[model samples]
Target chain A: MNKKIKTYYLLTAFTIFMFGFSYMLVPIYEVFCEITGLNGKTGSINSTLVIEKPVERFVRVQFTSNVINSAPFKFSPGKKEMVIQPGKIYTTFYTLTNQSNQPLLATANPSITPGKYAEYFKKIECFCFTHQQINANETKELAVQFIVDKKLPSEATSLVLAYTMFDITKQLGYKLEK
Target chain B: MNTDADHLHEDHKTGIMRWITTTNHKDIGTLYLFLSLTMFFVGGAMALIIRAELFQPGLQLVNPDFFNQMTTMHALIMIFGALMPALVGLANWQIPLMIGAPDMALPRLNNWSFWILPFALGMLGSTLFFEGGAPAAGWTLYPPLVLQGGDALPYAIFSIHLLGLSSILGAINIIATILNMRAPGMTLMKMPMFVWTWLITAFLLIAVMPVLAGAVTMLLTDRFFGTSFFTASGGGDPVMFQHIFWFFGHPEVYILILPAFGVISTIIPTFSRKKLFGYDSMVYATASIALLSFIVWAHHMFTVGMPLAGEIFFMMTTMLIAVPTGVKVFNWIATMWKGSMTFETPMLFSLAFIVLFTIGGFSGLMMAITPVDFQYHDTYFIVAHFHYVLVPGSVFAVIAAVYFWLPKWTGKMYDETLGKTHFWLTTIFVNITFFPQHFVGLAGMPRRIPDYAVQFTDFNAISTIGSFGFGIAQILFLYILYKTLKQDVTADNKVWEGAEGLEWTLPSPPPYHSFEEPPKVE
Candidate 1:
């Protein structure tokens, strides 16, 4: 009987451990992404990898921008495309207009087409990494400074950097109403 | 120690109150079975509604959104509510009796596990009344889309948590009872296949159910607590949700079917008048299948865009599962190879389970070829694959078990003619309903859509008619069960001529506390 009770306790403890392991997968998944670069999740550039010799090759980078339907904003790329030499820095901007009557808090999410280029597409400075607040009917320009790594795979000739802007204000507005 | 017959009068109550308050394993088992049967009808109704809408294609019975809700709710109720609970119900009744134990190791916990289900199901069923209707994101509950759903999301999450808790507790009790409460000298290897299958299944429940709990908890936090666990915009990956979900979801498929293996293992041998051909190998095969279940989860996500290496690894592992599964099937066939055979409802169901489940298995193999899955993913072919496994594989086995054991359970004979009729109708209609799905899927009709291209019209109509036929057959099943319960043509201890097991040693309609004094096994 005592043994049975002890086994029960042990099994219960194992269940609790599994509960912890479920949460542990969050960090585990992040680490796995960092290692495999799966899902186009990018890693921050450190000076250590920048020591590679620059290549003379040029890659055409096109910019695409759009706003979600529920988010009352107009967004477009300042320039449609730019040709940059591999291992060189390039700068671009996107124009945003708040079409709503109230102030809007917007955040931009970035994705690179073909996915393989996401790891090599390094952002030195970008509005996507920060939050922007625009007054009612206000227009604003956001800058994105980036570098194409020398290690960008040889088969990658072109890339599309797409940014989708979400209005957090309206998202939170529904919450406040609730 | 009192013999079972001597203790027949031991304060056993007979009424609704007895069911509500009783801690006896048998009472709890009965509760679980009745609840599961009720849910089977409810889920089946939802399936019929889905078929009715999809019958002629373009928005026939329901709009697209409500149609999505029906598909989603139908899966949830049938998998969690009907099939799982029924297996657990069978385990509760059979395990103790088969092992020569008086009752489960933890009776009160057993009662608690059974009782939590009704409330969980109530919470789940009530989601249909919510403003957005019940969880239109399908049972996968993938985020971003799922997050857009209204009040039903939270209710669905809560119900899942309750259901997971119930299954976990039930698993713990089964483990404890099997490990600690076995009759002296029965020995681990000597234990019956049903007990062995359930023993492994309990471990599976313990392992993966918590992962499901974890996944749903993350979803809950993401929805209500402003956490970004699955919000890709906030440094979280939405695909990670699929990874975690199928981690639980893959094994969940096995949890639904392994008991069916046990049921078939038992029935095949009895009808063949032989001991199971490869008893030891069957045990090893079950363990192998359980072990392989963990590594092969990503097969379900083949179309989710995994890396080539990850795809190859998952594809290989998924294909590897067929080996042990084939072992189980081969052993069943070998058991019935040359022995004297009979075709009762249970035996017929087992025979069909082997052939049809193999077809499902072959389709699963086709999907395992990573490139092939690209075409089959999210199509009716995928739907046909799982339904074949689940309906003929798991659900058929459950019905077979009930029919096989009904005489013992009720101490009366079910009408043989009616039983065989139910069996034949179910077999034919089940095939009719699901087989055409393969053609429609290969023709590229995506699932969960209420409206479809006119090209899919013919097959969809045939499938719907088949579903209605299958639905009517179950009503006959319900009537058969009812008639058996109401009448009392006393059954003998060994209900079948060739039956052999600890369970067959007991009186028909086993005493309220079976094996009050544990039987000594040779």
Candidate 2:
């Protein structure tokens, strides 16, 4: 081939090779993404929290808690201090005793902030955030199981969990801190 | 025909201004190719920016709105700018040769079609730098949201109008040329596959361009006037807009792929050293695909809460299409079977096309299942599926056609080693970019999101890097094109030993006006 013809062939060959090479690269990169999760981090709940508690309760019981920086608390019991590690679920129990001479009623209410994120993290089975009636001198224990997000930043070290016990008769609420 | 006599007397000059002013089919084809090349680079650059943004997640390179614009424009550019124009380029260059016509039936109309594209794309691209940026509501342009765009909306809408007009005119010109300008002995059956494919494709264009024109015009009126074509509050159903749009849109897909089919049909037989298998069946299959396209519009709208009966009707019809498509595929394989196959660049690309496009077709079948589509809809999986079809399917066919015909067009042979190198690199990188998208979609990642939850970060990063590699690979294509035009390589009248068609009967770099005396056909 003449110099001009040689150049033409070289150029045409180069163009075809480039398109073919690019075509092959698509699947390889796909496999890399699946293996590395470099595109996005993937995590599933290592453990789920299960809680068992009695419905009726009486007495002024306060719940409060703090979470360590590495672990972000997803839930808390009414006015009790609890500690848990990241990637691990922990459960705590609290008992309330009715001391009034007559029948006494009490209830626990739960709520969270950053509402959208809370919707995904917080779990409740029933309408248990309302008041419950109890006979005088009755006793009950409330329990909750919860997991902290391991993906939480280390800078967010301490998380506050607070709960209040309310007397339905007097419309009085008591706060608990831990 | 008398058109040949007229073509002979037309002024054919040899300078740059001649190319700019010329109405000859050959000159217009050259113009279309050059224009599409420029747009290809422009669109490729936008895609690179999108990949860069997804490289590490978060708002790193651009804000969400701008990111959306990049994605939307990237799609529009590749589909409209790159694929459509390239096919038109091929049509301009090959249709007359295939039909044994001296020139296009309406040469001025051909020039009009070729000239309008630049202005249309210019208007569309200018919106990116304008106040409030380009149309960021994705290329689908679903109403209520698209109406919310600022100054860019009118520009984008008008640009679409121009593009539609250009396509309509081009279609009209093709129809006239094919119907009126065939060689004396050429009957419909005797016409080459490329010409037949374009004849059907052009009819489809005439039928649907008006629908698109009408739909977009209504959109313009809905935005600016008190018209309520798409506004839900105005008693017009928003869902109806999708119906009208996809009515034009589904056939639009066939419009893009059929010419590609024609190109591949021509290339595969030539390289395999065999006459095309089932020539009549191929013709019938093209017609079937085009006709089925009209009814399958509702498949795209299955998720929009259509009635069960409508869904089933559209679903079955869409699935039925696979039959004709399968016929085409089987015919291609049968053509290559037991033939003396050569591993030329064109043949290599054609072989890759058969395998890869079938994968695209299979995924499309999966989408045809309404229940399955619900899960895959609006996800990265859809992205992966279409790219497989468009990139390796239509786009690769165009490249193959270019390689197959470049020697004849330029009268020079291109470098084989570099061609193979480019091919291997592109084929590898393309899959890396789109394949992982399937996994990400299955993993619940949505499409069109600028940032994703941390879980999706890993795959997104890999896809992004792969995209960069794929984008840069096209530079090699440009280099090769430049080299071919600049060189003076000698080529025989029949560029490939197995090549058949009236085009090969002419000299290398065929005359501006060919077939002054139409040759006898057997």
Best by lDDT: 1
lDDT by residue (A152-177, candidate 1, tens digit) is 88999998898988776644444322
C-alpha DockQ of every model: 0.55, 0.01
Error of 2 at A100 (Å): 52
lDDT (10s digit) by residue, model 2, range A1-178: 4443343344334434533433333345334433433222122343443224322321221246332221211224444544445444455554555666555445544433222222222322222344555556766666755444545444444443343344443322222111
Best by TM-score: 1
Location of the lowest summed lDDT over 10 successive residues in candidate 1 chain A: A169-178
Candidate 2 segments exceeding 4 Å error = A1-178, B1-10
Best-fitting candidate, scored by DockQ: 1
